[model samples]
Target: MADPTPLSVFDDLRAESDELDDAVAELGPERWALQTPASGWTVAHQIAHLAWTDHSALLAVTDEDGFRELVEKALAAPDSFVDEGAEEGARMPPAELLARWREGRTALDQALRAAPPGARIPWYGPPMSAASMATARLMETWAHGLDVADALGVTRPPTDRLRHIARLGFRTRDFAHVVHQVPVPADPFRVELAGPSGELWVFGPEDAPQRVTGPALDFCLLVTQRANRADLALRAEGPDADRWLDIAQAFAGPPGTGRPAKGDAR
Candidate 1:
């Protein structure tokens, strides 16, 4: 794998956000109220959450104290925040919802551009650099957008920018270890990803004997827990290979309960 380029990472984020905007705009009002594959979240709820998150990201970039206050506010808000947001959103015509989404996204874009290079921003979990925060926001939008598309039976095209999201999954290998209380292997392993666009993204040493490979979207979905790992064609070789794949995660916070492996469901 070549050295990970920062410029490429930024480009990936830009592309991912743009694609998500297009997908969200394409959904009709009926589809916006439709239930998504994610438990209890409708398409409107998804967009609302994304909008709320962008607001949170802005706070992270500009005001850490305010960000914490907002999280507390969300927690203190009505237990039916998601339902309320969805219902309110459902009442809006498609154009209105799309307009709100665009407005929030524009603010997020401005926040990303204005943030200092090394700024450490508060996140839903640990603090992260401005770049990492932007990356996280992009990943969430794309991953949730996938849920909306799946609910609507619309196929989203692959984008080169997914590589940015994939890189977050790669970096989270360490977080996964900490959450699972499993020690990561000190020995470096090669990571080669075939993205949704059929482009190969590699990290670690090119010649490293151990490797992880599969469809990029599947890999992203698995790491995000949007899809079961077994549904993906991921393969690992070497002593600790299987263990690493077992707990792969892309997001911060406590480790999630991964979906059951194929044929293992009750």
Candidate 2:
């Protein structure tokens, strides 16, 4: 069978939502307030943010005027908008918040499916094609899902779905450099990851001198800022590749302070 298409990325998004929901389903109120690895955010805040974004994404597609108003409001209070939204959402009853999240994601899925092939949707970062928007949603779901998993001390087994994230990370290599005002590498780095199923997933030129080689899960985690790059067994073969690993981020925003290596926390 062929690999999933960009449009099919929504299947992966649904899978992530299901897995994360299942993981958090049985938590009591105390567990809801447990802090995640994302500083200043509890488990509830994580889900709340996802809920808000999914709803915002729906607005972006179906109601441009409302979405623009939202953008203006967000810009007016740039630094605190996201945190404030999540904090406000956390005030809902835990079950209510979960229901709202489920509903918002369901609506988002419907909106994306109904969107035309070439449609572009505005977002907090860049405006995105329908497929790109879906993939971004998937990436965020997986990244925050990791935080929720960690807070619960649960080890969620990785799946081949990480291939989507790894691909996004590699494609964003130049975005990573450009955002930091660093010069984009003239030559692209080859990326070869051993997929969870043991298939080789290769990106970039096989003959490229600069290369990143590792397990797909590790690369995904590294790009999402969920794992410390130093702790991962990934190898970089050239100066550009090495520097890319040090600053690679799959999500948009200012450069992130990545997680610390195990046993190295302050």
Candidate 3:
């Protein structure tokens, strides 16, 4: 299947970042420190991490030395870097964090816009073109924003713009294959996504028989392991369908242990 258009993905990244900024801005100080659904991070830490990450991502994309330096900085930061950053963040309040986040994001955006078409940039994993880097950032912000929302018992208004994040799920098939030590599937299967607004996104050949379908938010949560697939309405059809669902991953790096079983939520 053809890859997503670069401009579309870039637009999604900007929009998702802006939405997350708004959500963070709305939280009171006490709520910012509340523990999130993510195992080890609090709401404040999640926001701080976004700031730290965006800065790091920009360095990684622009200057090789700067990328290495940031990694060294992360290694040297206190064990509670997130907490420390959050503590510092609290002093400035949400408005400040939102400002910092936007400034860092703007720098990255400028760099991305300035890069020549097809120019490759260094990333934490494999090098990616500017377009891919922006898409990755979009996925990261959206996933982490979910953590913050879950902690506060707030639900983010789902947007069709998140199709970019959903598209990443399809691209990460290779990551899943490697994590499972299985050969990549040569025959493409149909991926039918039901967005939060009831919009459908179809990937792969029109005639491909296999199908995966569910609410876009649920699919994102499942793939990101923020929620269990059983909690979602997702379903698979066709011979190899179950297996694909079993190992689907939408991000770079290793496979996560799937979420606890349906009855085990605690």
Candidate 4:
């Protein structure tokens, strides 16, 4: 399949958010306060973080200076800023929190659509095209939605939408090494993922000696650090590739203190 267009990714973002909304829309205050697998974050915190990030994305797309201020705040409180954002939004009544998320995400969709073709948008990390921004948002929604689903003792079936994240996980190979203070491999590693729909998604040289392969769902979970690698079904066929699995993270930040392996907590 061809790369997803900006409009298509924007559509996917809407769908992902809507699906999450369906999960949480009718929750009572008690349900909203239920703790999720994300350490201190509650169900409300998951949605609030999404809403807060959506609003931040909107500012980045529309107001570079404003986004810079947010970046400054993040720099000043690198460890606590993300939690702070989620906490602020989570404090609102559930109904208001939901409304804010809906409004902010809808506005972001509009802004992305109106953006001039090929224009770059400012971001917490590097500037990105509208399509990349939409894809990043979709990836986050799916990951956090998983936390919400787990909190509710439910499951969310994987979707081909994770292809974007899988692609990102592969593309960020060097980034993963860099963040871990490891030198990037000189040769590229091949990656092959089976999409949720069973479509083959391939990246890198077909004949590369180093390779990573897995269900797209597992790769997405691994790179997002939502599930511990030991609990996932991914495989790495080279030393560097193996190390990539150990530290892969698609989202920009300090290394995530990823989830513990199943049944092993200290």
Which is the leading candidate under TM-score?
4
Candidate 2 lDDT score relative to the true structure:
0.90
- C-alpha RMSD between model 1 and the true structure: 3.3
Q: Model 2: per-residue lDDT, tens digit, 63-96?
A: 9999999999998997888888899899999999
Please give the distance, in angstroms, between residue 92's alpha carbon in candidate 4 and its true position after superposition.
0.6
Worst 10 residues of 2 by lDDT: 1-10
Q: In lDDT terms, which candidate is top?
A: 4
Clashing pairs in 4: none
Tens digit of lDDT per residue, candidate 3, span 1-266? 23568877777888888887777777677887789876656787788777877887788767889888765655687355445655665456666777888899999988887889878887656789888888888888888898888888888887876677777777776677788887777677777887777778876687777767777777677667767776778888875655777787777655677667669946
Task: Estimate, for each residue in 190-220, the C-alpha lDDT of model 4 and write its tens digit.
Answer: 9998998889999999999999998999999
Looking at model 2, the pairs that clash are: none
Per-model CA lDDT versus the true structure: 0.74, 0.90, 0.76, 0.92
lDDT of 3 at 50: 77
* Candidate 1 clashing pairs, residues 3+ apart or interchain: none
Question: Cα deviation of 126 in candidate 3 (Å)?
Answer: 1.8
Q: lDDT at 102 for candidate 4?
A: 96
